[model samples]
Target: MRWSKALIPTHKEDPSDAETTSHKLMLRSGYIRKLTSGVYNYLPLGRRALLKVEAIVREEMDAVGCQEILMPVLSPSELWKETGRWDVYGKELWRVRDRNSREFALGPTHEEVVTDIVRNEVRSYRELPFTLYQIQTKFRDELRPRFGIVRSREFLMKDAYSFHRDEESLDETYKSICDAYTRIFERCSLTFRPVEAATGAIGGSHSHEFMVLSDTGESEIIVCECGYAATDERAEGAVDPHPCDEAPGEMERVDTPGMKTIEQVSEFLGIEPHKLVKTIIYEADGRTVAALVRGDREINEAKLSMALKADLVVPAPPDVIEKLTGAPVGFAGPVGLDGIDVIADHTVEPLVNVVVGGNAQDVHLKNVKPGRDFKVTAFHDIVLVRKGDRCARCGAELNSFRGIEVSQAFKLGTKYSSGMNATFLDEDGVAKPFIMGCYGLGVSRTVAAIIEQHNDKDGIVWPLSVAPFAVEILVVSMKSEECTTLADTLYTDLKTAGVEVLYDDRDDSAGVKFKDADLVGMPLRVTIGARGLKSGVVEARVRKTGEVSEIPVDDAVQGILHILETLR
Candidate 1:
């Protein structure tokens, strides 16, 4: 590709709405341009990089014995409705309708469509235990998409689904896919961790997310030195129960004014936040339930939903809370709460005296004791794990990191098969639901994450394996016929040698060419200038290391290829 003809529109200023490093760099580098909120148009350079990523993903998936297939981005509503996800997937499902008033959805994922294919085609266990993968576009109605393509509404994804006859087969394939994922990210030069994750909306028995470590990431992960890692929503750590050696104190209602938050109430009562119990009312599967936790902690809604065995769990609306507790939003309490289930965090079990809501305006209860003042229907670990918390596996203090989730693997078991009746006949002639697994790699997001981790102030430092071009031949002085001729000769030689090379043949100044080269960040750069030509050599620089070497004019192609090999 020639820079004079290519649409590499490098910019000097950042986009006004760009917040993260990746977003700002991508715009300035001319990789993508915003078409609308949460949507972008990939330019030539961006498309080339994306294709390389897709090629890597395809190779990895193929090496794992997975067959490639394509599915429609517009999926029928019947398939999602069959799995009960049409309503359960929430507003992000991108629901639509055809002219005939038939419903459809732009698929955020392909689990339902894949399951439909398997159920219709395969009927025997002999054809089971195979994986099908597709690299395609996916859509989601993101309420607030930010960070450029990292959280875009429309993006490229490589999603794979596997079907199995039994749990053992599913487990075997799951491990293989996870291993492939590790290799995929490593090949892209990403520093990441695979952490246990909650299977949100994508119903599954177990899942792990490949999180690229970055301070600008949107997801929070809890990590331990003992190899225990999980997304904060799925992390489990030891919590010490409140120590109470003294007898239970009598609960008393006290009045202040307008103390709604835990901080406000604790400040008004002159007590630490840990000394108070937070009563959080939620609508778990349409049943009103109150969850109790230490005021200093936060409720993990994923854990709460799992504990209640509910399909959905959301905080009750203000109106519902006011009607249930006879008070405003933050004043609900479990004391004397009637006609509802109450679940308490394990950290609150041993408390003898604590503060709680008074269930009335401008009121709070002090010295309230659990088991004496309110009844807890059950106790579970429902608090979000934090730094300094004890690890459940090794008893070490936990560490936390913000990360970008680039890929995720799920052991779906029979979540979709059971729901949609995707079954195969076994040797015993009994129909059994197919055990399934899902693996997804965010192709577009990985590109953004790579920039988030691999970039400096100059621009994106692309890994050679996924770089848009392996070598860039810059004619530093196009005005000099000698420099332009030498650059063209080297470009031809490299192209003939099967190198992915880009030629900056435009009549641009040395400074502009150098700046654009750094912004695009090719792996290797060969500078052919009049001064260098006079010296019988060309300047070669490695983008990542900034290592410069003088390559003899006669050996420019060979030297550039050698440097690219080392980059790989």
Candidate 2:
């Protein structure tokens, strides 16, 4: 590719709306252009980089004996309804209607469609334990898409689904897929951690997320020195009982006008946040329940759903709260409350004389003690794990960090197959649902994450394995015939040697060419200038290390190839 003909439009200023480093660099480097709020058009350079990532994913998946197959972008609503995900996915599933009034969904994931296909085709146990994968586009109606392609509404993904006859078969395939994921990310030069994660709407027994460590990431993860790592939603919080010995005072209600938040109530009552218990009202599976946690802690809704064994768990509406507690929102408490299940966090079990809502308008209860003032139906680990929290494994202090989720693998079990009635005949002539597993790698997001981890002050420092071009040849003085002739010759020689080289044959200034080269982040650069030509050598600069060396003019091609080998 020649710079004069290539559409490598770079800018001097970053986009004002860009909030992350990857977003800013991708725009300024002319890799992509925004078409809409959550949509982008990948230019030539960006397309090449994405293709490289896709190739790696294909090789890894194929190496694991997973066959490649393509599914439709639009999946029928019947398939989603068979699995009861039509309502479970909520507004995130993109719904559309055909001219004949038939409904279809733009697939966010293909669990339902794949299950439908397998159920119709595979009828015997002999055809079980196979995996099918596809590299295609996925759509989701993101409420707030941010951080460029990291959270885009539409993007490219590589998703694979496996079918099995029993738990043992599913387990074997799950481990192999996880191993392939590790190799895929390693080859892309990403520094990541595979942490246990919640299954979410996927309805799986367990899952693991590959998170690239970055300060600008949206998800928080907890890691312990004992090799126990998980997303905050899945990490277990160790219950440390701070047993208070103070004698319980009689509960009394006081008029705290307009102080509802913990900060406001604590400041008004002259108490610490830990001395107060917060009552959160949630509607779980059409039943109202109250959850109690320390004011300083947050309720993990995922944990709450698991504890309740409910398909859906969301906060109660303001009207429901008002009708149940005889007060406005934020004033509902467990004290004097009846006919509703009251679940308490383990940390709230050893409290004495803790303040709580008064179950009335602008009122709060003081000197209230658990087991005396209210009844807790059960206790569970239902709080978000944070820094300084003890790990459940080795009791070490857990550390928290932010990261970008690049890939995830789920042991789906029979969630989809059982729901859709996808079964196969066994040796005994009995039919049973196939055990299933799901694995996904975000191809586009991996590109963005690579930039997040491997970027410098100038621009993206692409790794050699996934770089758009392996080498960039810069003609420092295009006006000088000697420099031009040597650069053209080197460019042809490098091409003949099977190197992906970008020749800057444009008549631009040396400064402009050098700046663009650095911005595009080619792995290696060869500088052919009149000054260097006079010294009987050409300059070779490594993009990652910023180390420059001189190669003798007689051996430019061989020297460049050797440096490329060192880069790998």
Give each model's whole-structure lDDT: 0.91, 0.93
Measured against the true structure, the TM-scores of the candidates, in listed sequence, are 0.98, 0.98
The global Cα lDDT (0 to 1) of model 1 is: 0.91
- Candidate 2 lDDT over residue span 238-286, tens digit each: 8566668898899989888998899999999999988899999999988
* Candidate 1 structure quality by residue, lDDT tens digits, 240-324: 6557687777888888589999999989989889889999999988999999999999999999999999989999988999999
For model 1, the superposed segments whose C-alpha errors exceed 4 Å read none
lDDT of 2: 0.93
lDDT score, candidate 1, position 407: 93
Give me the runs in candidate 2 sitting further than 4 Å from their true place.
Answer: none
Where's the lowest-lDDT run of ten residues in candidate 2? 236-245
Kindly give the stretch of ten consecutive residues in candidate 1 with the minimal lDDT sum.
239-248
